[model samples]
Target: MASNGMESMQLAEDQIKILEENFNRVSKHPDESTLMLIAAESGLTEEETAKWFRLRNAQWRQAEGLPAQLGSVKD
Candidate 1:
């Protein structure tokens, strides 16, 4: 059960990377009009888009590597 949750989290992280790249490409002005639109089109809320990118940017700090960053910390 716990492992399933972990897998889902990792998939989320991978998705974050893709979105981060997309955001960077479009957000060169940092205030581009499409920021909201892109986030919405990606099926993520404005808040969730911001949150996931934060995690994606921090991927380098993850010791287990990107795919294993959210592994069962308890198990």
Candidate 2:
């Protein structure tokens, strides 16, 4: 029930395809330049692309029985 917005975001078929393509190409953390390029090509903001990758990676890690923070660096 947290309200961070975009919870109701419904991507169009084209947008979904674009995102899916990018996701498959870079399931792990993508660099800022690549992400920005993807965002521009997919008509999404960099933040949205980053969030999508984060959530997708979390799901992937969960399925693989790995910690969600596996590749993340801790301070």
Candidate 3:
């Protein structure tokens, strides 16, 4: 059971790494196709990928002293 928990944590860490790499290199507010690609790469569902982006954006905005609101992706 403890091993299972550790595996889960490691999996989560791997997923986060994938997501973070895409978020930094790609668009923070990715389009549907981009989101799908990222989700597939991260081994996450589309909804989960979207939620991760949303939460990450909020965290970044807070860190930058901006309001935690959704913003349009730059072209």
Candidate 4:
């Protein structure tokens, strides 16, 4: 569990590598089918994969001096 009382999910190093490679080389806003494939490749659920992409995109936007909430994942 996390400090916030929610279950904490930690990705293994290999999983992180997989996700990072995809994020760098592929579309940031992946479609549903792509999300399914990524989830399978990373050994995560579709929901988890989508959440990871959402958080990663926000971080990327923030790093680029853009608002974290500037756009939706569907954008």
Candidate with best lDDT: 4
Q: Candidate 3: which pairs clash?
A: none
Worst 10 residues of 1 by lDDT: 1-10
Q: What is the lDDT of residue 22 in candidate 2?
A: 80
Residue-wise C-alpha lDDT for candidate 1, range 1-75, written one tens digit per residue: 233222244436555565766756755222334556656666667655555544543443353355634444421
Model 4, residue 41: distance off in Å is 0.5
lDDT of 2 by residue, 1-75 (tens): 354333455667787688778878764778999899888988889988777777667667768998866765631
Given candidate 3, what's the lDDT at residue 51?
75
Between candidates 2 and 3, name the one with more favorable TM-score: 3
**Candidate 1 wrong stretches, greater than 4 Å:** 1-24, 27-34, 60-75
Per-residue lDDT, model 1, residue 18, is 57
Give the clashing pairs for model 2.
Answer: none
Q: Taking the tens digit of each residue's C-alpha lDDT, what string does model 3 give over 1-75?
A: 123222233348789899989989998889999999999999989977887787778778878999877556532
Which sequence of candidate numbers ranks them by TM-score, best first?
Answer: 4, 3, 2, 1
RMSD of 1: 8.5
Off by over 4 Å in 3: 1-11, 71-75
Q: What is residue 71's positional error in candidate 3, in angstroms?
A: 7.2
Compared with the true structure, all predictions reach lDDT values of 0.50, 0.73, 0.78, 0.81
